[model samples]
Target: MTAHLSRRTLLGIAGAGAGAYLLSACGSDEPSTPDGPQTINWWHIQNTEPMLPVWAAIAKEYETAHPNVKVVIQPLENEAFKAKLTTATQAGSPPDLFQSWGGGVLKQQVDAGLVKDITADVQPWIGSLLPASVQPFTIDGKIYGVPFDVGMVGFWYNKDLFVKAGVTATPTTWAELLTTVSTIKGKGIVPMALAGKEKWPGHFYWAYLAMRIGGLGALQQAAKDNNFDTPDFIAAGQRLKELVDLQPFQKGFLGAEYGSPDGQAATMGNGGAALELMGQWAPSVQASSSTSKKGLGDKLGYFAFPAVDGGKGTVAEAFGGGNGFVVGKDAPASTTDFLKVLLDAANQRKSAATGAVLPTVKDAADAIKDPNSKVVAASLASATGFQLFLDQAYPPAVGQQVNDSVAELIAGSKTPEQIVKDITKVAKSQ
Candidate 1:
C-alpha cells in the first residue's frame, strides 16, 4: 500500500531544530583549494556487488574527466566502517568524504567540527533530489550532506509460503498480523525472519509498533523530553511481546546475522520463513546470500507495517532512513562537485537499475525496475510521516539502549515496563 505525507508533518518529524547547536560548534579549518591537484578520500559501506563496482567506476570516470583530481576509495563493511569512522572522527581527522546516515551521529560530527556545511555548494543541483531524501542531511537550515539513496522499512514476504499457510491477503491491522502469524505457525512454517544477533533488525518491530500506537510525534516528543516512559511506548513493547510469545521466528534466530548464509535474509529468501521486516535493500541481500543466489525472485512481495486498532499514527507514516555522504571539514572545494556527479540523474538511475538502491533523485524514480522496489518507492513518496531509523535518530547511548532493551524483551529477559524504564534511563542520561 502507498502512504502520503503532508509537507508540514514531514518537516516536523524531520527534526529541523534538533541540531541547531551543531552550527555554532562546527567551525571548519582551512578550506582545500580547487586549484592544481587534490585527492579526495572517500569511505563507504557498499563493499559488495553492484554498488562496489558502480561506485568505483564513477570515481574512475571522474578522475578521467579531471586528471588533476584523484579519488581514493576505501570500501568497508557496515559495522567495521562505523567503528573505524568513530575512532577517526574522535581523533578530529575523518575521511575527506565518508558514508553518513544523517541524524544524531551526523550532528555529533558537525558539533565536533569534523564535517563541512555544504548548503551553498550543493544548492545549484540540490533541487533535482527529493526533499525528503535531503531532509535527513539538513541541520537547522543548512545542508551538510547529499543523499544518493532513500527508502523505508516494510514486510518482504514469501508469497508461496503465505499461500501454503492459507493467508489469502497481507495483514493490514495489528490483530490481523498476529492472526496471520499464528496461522503460518499452525502450518508448520516460520512466520518471520529476524536478525536478533544484529539487534537493529529486531528494533524495527518495536519502533514500528511505537509509531503505530503513539504516532510519529510521540517519538520526537519522547526524545525532546528525554523520556520514553509513556503509555504508547509501553504498549508498543506489550504488543511486540504478544508477537514474540508466538515463537514465530526461525530456529536459533537469536544468533542469526543479517546477510550471512544462515542469516535473516537467506532464511527469508530460501523460504525458511514467511516474512521479514526490512528495508528496500532486503531483496538484493537475500539474493546474494541465498544458496541459489537467486532468492525467491517473483515470489517475493512487499507491504507496509500493519496499523494498530486505536493507534494515533496511520499506516501512511513511514520508518526508515537513506545512505548519504558527508564532506569532511578539510575536503577539497571540489568535493561537493564530485558528490554532485555521484548523484547526477544518470548515475542515480544506474544505481536504481541495479536493484540495490532506491534512488534519491526525483527523476530517477522511474528507473526502478524491480516490482518490490517500486512498491517501497511509492510508499515512501506517499508517506504521511517519516522517522529516521531509531538507531540513528537519537543520541548514540539512547538509541543503543532502545536496541539493547528491545533485544532483552524479545529474549524474555525483560518485561515491557522494564524495557521502557531501561530506555528512559539512558535517554535521560543522554
Candidate 2:
C-alpha cells in the first residue's frame, strides 16, 4: 500500500513516537543527479520477489523511452514503507514518486498540500481503467492517483481439504461458512488461517464482517461520522469473536507474523488448515513455495465474503482497491514523464504478462496471460465497492487502537461492544 504527499507538509500529526521512524525511512539520499539527467526516486511496497522481474522490465522500458531520465526503484515492506514515507514527508525530503493507497490517507496528505494534483497529467488515460478502481482514490471529485491492480480480500479455501470434508461448494452465506468451518474442524483440519499477531491482517476480518453485517451504506455513514460505537460495529466484532471460539484458525496463527512466506507455507503445506481469509497477496505465497501447497492457481478456490444470512448486506460487498504511483512535491517534471513512460500500454502489458500485477493503466488487464490473473481481474471488476485497507484509512492513533482492540478480541479480553465503544471514542476524539 502507498500514500502520496505533495512537497513535504503533513497536517494530521501522528503521535511523537511515530514521527521518529518516519524520519529515518525518509532520510535524504545524496543528490544523485540534477542538471545532466533527472533522476527520480520511486518508493513502493510491492514486496513480492517475483515482481522484481516486472519492475525491472518497467525500469528498462522507461529508461529506453526517457533516455535522460532515471527512475530509482525502492521496494519496501508495507508497514515499513508507510512509516518511512510519513517520516520523509514530515522531515521535508520525500521521494519524487511513491506508491500509495488512495482514500482518507491520500486525503490527509492532499489537505496538507503534500502531493501534487496529477489529474490533468493522467486525464488522457482516465477512460482506460475500470471505473471502480478509480472511485476509491477520487477525493472531492478529483483523482489523486492512478489505479494499478485492484484486489479483494476474502476466503481462499483448499479444494483438496474441502473434498476430504465432503463439502462440494463454497459457502454463500455467513451461516453456511460457519457450518463449513465447523464441519471441517470435525474432520480434524483447522478450518481457517487467521493471523492475529499481525494486527492489520486480523483487522480485515472485522472490516469485511462490518461490511457484511452493516451494509456499505452503514459502514460509510459510520466512517463519515466516526461512529464505530453503533450497533452494527458491535455486531461485526461479535461475529469475529464467534470464529475465535470455533478455534477454526491454524494453531499459532494468532501469533503468526504476516509477510513471512515460511509461516503461510508451513501452515497450508503441512498443517491441516483449509482456508485463509486473506487478500490476493496470499496466492503468491503458495506459488513461491516448493511444498505441496505451491502452484495452487485455480485450485486455490475463492468466494466473496458472504452476507450475514438474511442480513441487510449482500454478498457482493467487498474490500478492494489498487496500488499505484504518486509524485512528490519535490520531484522534477521528468518524474511525471518517467511515470508516463513506465505506464505506457506496452510496458503495462509487460507487467501483466509477467503475472506480478494487473495494470493500473486502461486496457492493461487484457495483457494478463496467467489464468488466475484473469480471474482476479474479473473479480475486481465485479466488486460492488471497495474500502482502502481499514487501518490505512484510519488515522494512525485510531488505526492502532482498532488494531489493538481486534487483538484483545482474539485474546478474549474484549467484547465486540467494548471494541466498538473504544473505536467510537477514538473516532470522536479525532
Candidate 3:
C-alpha cells in the first residue's frame, strides 16, 4: 500500500528525533509478480566486507529470478547514511528499504507517516524471529519493522583478572558487583575501563541501572509521561553514584576515546583493566585496538548487568540494539517481499555464520559459529524484555540529555537529583 507523508512530518522528525525498524528472517516466500517494471531503491550501512558481497549476490539472484524488478542498492557508511537518510526524509523521500535501529526514531517515522505498517505483510513469517528482538519495532501493537540481528550490552570482563583478585564468581547483585570492584581495586588493578569522554558508553550504566531498579515498564512509562523525575529514576542515579564513588575506572578515563590507542577497548584488550561494559562487538574491537592486535584470547568472559537488591527488573531484561531495515511508506509492494528474501531463514543462517550478526530468527541460532556470538544469540533467544539504547530510545534531545546528565553524574559534576531533573526537563520539552 502506498503512503504519503506531508512536509510537516519532516519538521516533526527533526524537531523531535529519529527512528528505525527491523525485520524477521525465516519463511521461504517468493516475490509476487508485479503489475509492471518497478525499481526498488535500497540503502543499508553494511558498506564493508563479507556482508557487502553477500547483499550484492542476493540482490543479483533476486533480479535474475524476477526480471521485472530492478534493485538499485546504495551501500553507505554509517554516518554518511544517517546524513543522507536525514536529507531524504526531509525531502519526504526515503529509500524503499534502509537501515534502522528501531526506537524513538522509528516511532517518529511512523507518527509522521513515513514508514509502512507492515504487520500484515510480515505476520505470516514474523513468528520465526525471537519475540524480544521484535519488541523495539512493535509500536501501538503494530509491527513497522522486523529485526534480523539483535544483541545486548553487558559486562565483558577479563577472567584472569577476576581470578587474580581471588574472585570466584561473577557478581549477581549490585552489592556483589560493588564488592567485586573494590576487591579488584584492592589488588591495585583497575576495576573497569570506560570511555568517559564519549557519553554514549557511560549512558549504558545509567540505563541498565534504571532497568534493574525501575523495570523496563518504568522506562516506557517515563517516555510516555514525559517525566523522568521519578523515585525509581532518582534511585537509579543514586545506585550509579554508589559505583562511581568507588572511582573504579582507569587513570585517564575521563578523557579517553572508545577506540583510540589508549581508549577503553584497547585498555581492556591489553589487560590494563578488569572489565568493560560493551555490546557484542567488544571482542573484535578490543583485538583490533590492542597493541598486539589480539585481545585477551581465552581470558575474556561476559555476564549480564548485575541485579539489584530490591529491584523490579531482572538480569533477563536486556539493553542494546542491532541492525534492521524499515520499508519506506511509499515503497513498492515487492519491497516487503524482497525483504522476505533478505531475511529468509537460510539467508539469516548465512549471515549468522559470517560471525558479524546475531540473527533474530530463533531457528537460525545454530548457525552462529562463534562461541561468544552464540552466547549473545542464546541470550536474545530467551530475553524476557529488551530496551533499546536510551540515546536512540528517546527523542534525540532527551536521549542526548540522558547521555550528558549521566556523564556529568559520573564526572562528579551532577547530583542524582539534578540529573533526574535535567533529564525530566528535556523529556517534558520533547
Candidate 4:
C-alpha cells in the first residue's frame, strides 16, 4: 500500500507542492481555529469491543476538554465503511475525520479534491510517531492522514496442529513450506484456511510471492512503468499456482467469508486448519469468530512469510498496513485540533492496552500485553523494510485488478502470463 523516504524527511519534502497549495486559494488549506461550537463528524471501523468503547471514551474526554467542539461518532464495519466512504467521496463529501488506510485510496481522494493537507497543522508532534507507519499517508511530500496503528502480515499457525502433523520446525524457505503443507494435509489435516470469497485475502499469497521473488522494488517499478509483464511477477504467479494445485485449503474455502462462523478465522481457531496467511489482527478475529471464542491461545504462533530459495527480498521485509484518520476537505478547523488530543501518548496507550493495535506513538509500546501481539510488535520493530499491502499500494483500479487477477490464478482460471497481461492493461490505463 505504500513507500516512503528517510525518517522525518517525508514531511520535510512538502516544499514546492505544499508551497504551491498554500499560495493558491484552494479550500482553506490552513483552516482557521474555530470561532464557535463545531461538530466534527468521524467515521471509524472499530465497531466492536476493546476499541469501540475506547474510541467513545476518547471522544467524550475530548469534548469535556473542549466544549466548543463536539465529536459525532459513526462506527461502521470494515467492508461497510469502505463501501460507504466510496459513495460519500464520490458524492463530493466525506466525514470530517474518517477511517483511512492511507495509500492508494487516500491518494485517490487527494487527487479528487476530497481531503485536506494537514502537514503544517501536525508539524509539532508528528515526529514523535513511528516514521514508517506515517509513510503511507505521505503522498507527493504532503501528509494527508495520521496513523494510529501499524502491523505486518505473516503465517499465523496452530503450533499444536504442527506437532500432531510431525512438522517440528516452522518453514523458513518456500520449498520447506510446501513440504510442511503436504505433510500436514497427509495427516488428514487442512493445511491452510483462506477466505476465498474475499479476493483481498487470496491476493496476499501472490503479493508476497512477488515481493520475495522480484524484491522490494519490483512492484514499485511495475507501477512506475505501468506494466507487470515481467519474469519476476510471472514467477510469483507460478509459485502461487503450485500451492493452489496442492489442494491444501479447507473444504468450501473458495466461498468462505473472513469473519463468518465457518470462515478462515474460525477454521484456524477451531484447529480445522494448521495455518492461515493473515495480517496481525488474526488472533483476535479468530477468537471472536471461533466456537470457543478463546481461539488457540498459546497454541498460536507467528512467523515471517517464507523466503523463495533464490529470492531477492529477505524475510525481514514486511507486508501490511494499519488504520489512520484523514481529514475531509470541508471539515471544520477544530477537526485537526481534536486529532492532536485523540492521538496523544496517553490516549494511544488506552488503545494499546486493549491489544487491538500496534501503537504508532513510540511511548505507548509498553501497553501491549497480549503475547501474540507482542511477537508481532517485535517483528515490526525489527523489520528491515516495509511495503503496504499490494491492493492499497497501487491506484484503486490497479489495486483491484491485482486482487481480481490473483484470485483468478488461485481459481485455476488464469495463467501467470495472463495475470500479468490483465494487470498491465489496467495499470497502463490508470
Candidate 5:
C-alpha cells in the first residue's frame, strides 16, 4: 500500500491563505537548496526486509543518474504511515511526493485538493497502460497519480493439510466450501486462518459478503454513502454469520495482533489450519520460515471467495487494488522531472524484478520473472473493475467501528445481525 503523509498538511498545501507561506518560512525546514540536488522525500509503506536490498539498489541507481536530484526513501509501517502523513500535511510539513492507494483514500486526498493533478504528464502514456490498472487513480477526467503495484484478496490453502484431510478438490460453491471446512475441522485441522487482529484483513469478509449479496456496485455505493442500514447490508452481515458458524477460522484469532509474525507462522506452519483468505501480497511462508521449501511455492493455492448461496453476484467478482505514488500539488519543476524519470521504463522494470510488486506499467509487468508475480499481473488484467480495500474505502470512524465489529463477531460477542446493526448505526450517524 502507499505510505500516508498527513492529509492535514496537504489541505494546507492546497490553499491556506497566507498562513501556509508564513509557516513555511518561519517553522518549516524545507528540503535545502532548490538550486542544488532537489531532495524529494519519498515515503512508502512497502516495508519488508526482503525489499530493502532492492530499494537500496534502485535508490543508488536513481541518484547516480540524476546527481541534481536525490530521492530520500522513508519506509513506514502501513497504518502508521497513513496517520503520520495525515497529521504532517495538516501541520504544513507535507512531502513533495508520497504514496497512496487509489479509490476512496485517493478520493479523500484529491477532494481535499492536496494531491497534484498530473494529467498532463500521464496523458501520453495512458494509451500504453492497462485500463484496469489505471482506473483507480483516474478521477474527474484527470490523473492525479501514477499506477504501481495492484493486488487482490483470495484464499491461500495448504495442499498438504488438504490431502491429509482427504479433500480431493478445491471448493467452488458456498455449500461445497462449507462442507470442505467441516471435513477439514473433523480431521483436526483448522479450516481457515482468518486473522482478526489485522482489521483490514477482517474487512474482507464484510466486503466480499456485501459483494455477494448485493453486487459490487451496491456494496461500494453503500460504503461510499455510508448506507449500512440498507437491507442488502444486513443480508451481507447474515452471510458472514453463516460462514462463522462453520468455525472455519483458527480459534482465538480475533484477539491476534496485526502483522504478528509468530501468529502467522503458527497458523500456517505449526497450527493445523488448511487455508487462509488473504491478499496476494502475503509472500510465501517459505520466505519467512527456515524450514524446507517443500509445500511452499506454487503449492499455495488461491481462489476467489465464493458468492452467497443465492446471491446477486458471481464467484468471479472480487475485492482488490493496492497502493502507489502520487505527486503533491505545487511540486517543484525539478521534482516533477525526477518523478518522470522515476517512472521511466528502466526504473519501473527494475522495481518489478524485485518480485515485491505487480507493476501497473506493461513493460515492468513483462519483466517480472516470478510466476506468482505474473499471476497477480494476469489477474489485474482480467478484473472487470478493481474494488478498493473495504476499510480504506469507508470513512475512518466507520472503518474503526467496522473493525471492532469484525473482532467482536469472530469472538462470538456479536452475532452477524448485531454486527449489521452496529455498522448500520455508524452509517446512519455518518
Candidate 6:
C-alpha cells in the first residue's frame, strides 16, 4: 500500500472520538459485562492455512470452556485488516482483541486512549515470556500488548547453492558479503531474491545497513529529533547502493511480489536464487508459495546479517519485529483471560509446531521443530540490541517515506544524499 493511503487511514483514527460513530448493536455504552452474555470481537491477520485453523480451534476451545462468553472472530488479510481496524477505531469502537505489531502504531493507539493498559492483568505470566518479546509492547514502563511470536531478520540461504558458488562459510562482514555475492553471480546463480514491488522487503537492506553503520541508538535519535539527514543514514544508502550496483537480484525483481509464485520467497524455495534476507517466517512462506508446495527441506540454512567493518553496530544487534495482540479500551474483562489462554505455553507450542511462528513463551521454545526457525530464535535470544521494522517503528508517513526513498535509491533514480534529505523532510513534517 502507498504511504498516502496508510497515513490517511491512521489520521482518521487519530482524529476520532468526539463525533465518531459507535456500534449500537454491540451496546457501546454499556459496561463490558452487565446483564447477559459477553461477546469479544476479535480481528486477526492469520487468515491463511495452518494458522487459520490453529487459531479457530483455539477460539473454539476457549468458547467451550466459557459458556457465557461468545467469541466473534473476523479474520482479515494484513492490509485489509489494518484499513478496517483504522475505520473502526475512528468510529470510536475497536475490536475487543486485535493483532498488534507493538511499535509506533501501538503507541499511537495508546496515546489516543484506544488500547487497554494490560500491565496489571498480565503481570503474573508476563515474566514467563522472553524479555525481548515484550520489549516493544512496553511503553513508559507499562505494557499495552502481549507478544505470541518473536523473531529477527537474517539471510536464509540454500546450502547447496552456496556450495555451487564455492562459498565455504557465511559472510560475517559487509566486505565479505559483497565478495560472496560476486562469487554467487559468477556461478550464474541469482545472488539474491528481492520483492522489490513490495517496498518493505527492499527497505530491509537500507535499514540493516543503517543499523550496522550507525548502531541502534542512531535510529532512536533520528526518530526523537525528527531528522534522518545524518552522515550515517547517508552512508547506509551509499552502502546499499553498492550492492545494487552489482545487479545481484533476480531479473525483473523490481516488479516482484513477496510471496507470489515468481517472487522472492518462491525464487529462493525453488532454488533459483542463492539467498533472501527475511524474517523467521521465510521458510513457511517459501514452502507455501512454491510449485512443489514444499521448500528446500534440509538445504535451507540461516545466518545473521553481516556486520560492517568499522561500524558502530555489532553482529549481535538484530533488526526485526513480531506479532502480538492488544486489547481495546472497552473490551470486556474476560478479554485478558482469553488472551492468557491463547498465549499459554501449550497453545504457543501448538502455534510453534506449525513451523510458522517463533514462540514468545520461554518454555514453548522446545516446540520449534524447524532447524531454520531454531537458528532465528537463538539469534533473537542473544541479540544485544533490537530494532523493529522501520515502517512499524515510525508514524505511517515517515515510515512510508523511508520505504519510498529506498526504492528510488535501488532504482537508480535518487542519490544517497537526496534519499536521506527526503526521509528527513517527511520525518520533520510528521
lDDT (0 to 1) per candidate: 0.82, 0.67, 0.81, 0.81, 0.63, 0.82
lDDT tens readout by residue for model 1, 185-243: 99999999988887878888999999999998898898788889999999999999999
Worst 10 residues of 6 by lDDT: 12-21
Please give the distance, in angstroms, between residue 71's alpha carbon in candidate 3 and its true position after superposition. 0.7
Clash count for each candidate, listed in order shown? 7, 12, 9, 3, 11, 0
| True lDDT of residue 404, candidate 5 | 76
Decoy 2 TM-score against native? 0.82
Looking at candidate 1, the ten consecutive residues that score lowest on lDDT are 1-10
Q: Which stretches of candidate 6 lie over 4 Å from their true place?
A: 1-37
TM-score of 5: 0.81
Compare candidates 2 and 3 on TM-score and give the better one: 3
Candidate 1 displacement at residue 83 in angstroms: 4.1
lDDT of 1 at 242: 97
What C-alpha lDDT does candidate 5 achieve relative to the native structure? 0.63
| lDDT winner, 1 or 6 | 1
Work out the TM-score per prediction: 0.87, 0.82, 0.93, 0.87, 0.81, 0.89
Off by over 4 Å in 1: 1-36
Q: Residue by residue across 1-430, what tens digits does model 6's lDDT show?
A: 3422221121111100110011112212222434357899999877776688899999999889888888999998767888899999998898999988777787789899999987767776777787777777776667788888887879999999999889999999999999999999998999999988878888989999999999987887887888889999999999999899999999999999887789888999899999999877788778877889999989999999999998999999878777789999999888988899999999999999886678889899999998888888888878777787888788778888889999999999999999999999888886
For candidate 5, what's the RMSD? 8.2
* 1-430: candidate 3 lDDT, tens digit per residue: 0000110011101111112223344444444557688899999767777677888988999989888899999988666777899899988898899878777888888888899988878877788888777877877777787767777888999999999999999999999999999999999999999988877889889999999999888988888888989999999999999999999999989999787889998999999999999888788778878999999878999988999989999999888877788899899878898888888989988887776777888888889876776787778777778888888788778888988999999999999999999999988877
**In model 4, what are the clashing residue pairs, if there are any?**
1-388, 1-389, 1-393
Better of 2 and 5 by lDDT: 2
Better of 3 and 6 by TM-score: 3
Query: Which regions of candidate 4 deviate over 4 angstroms?
Result: 1-37, 77-80
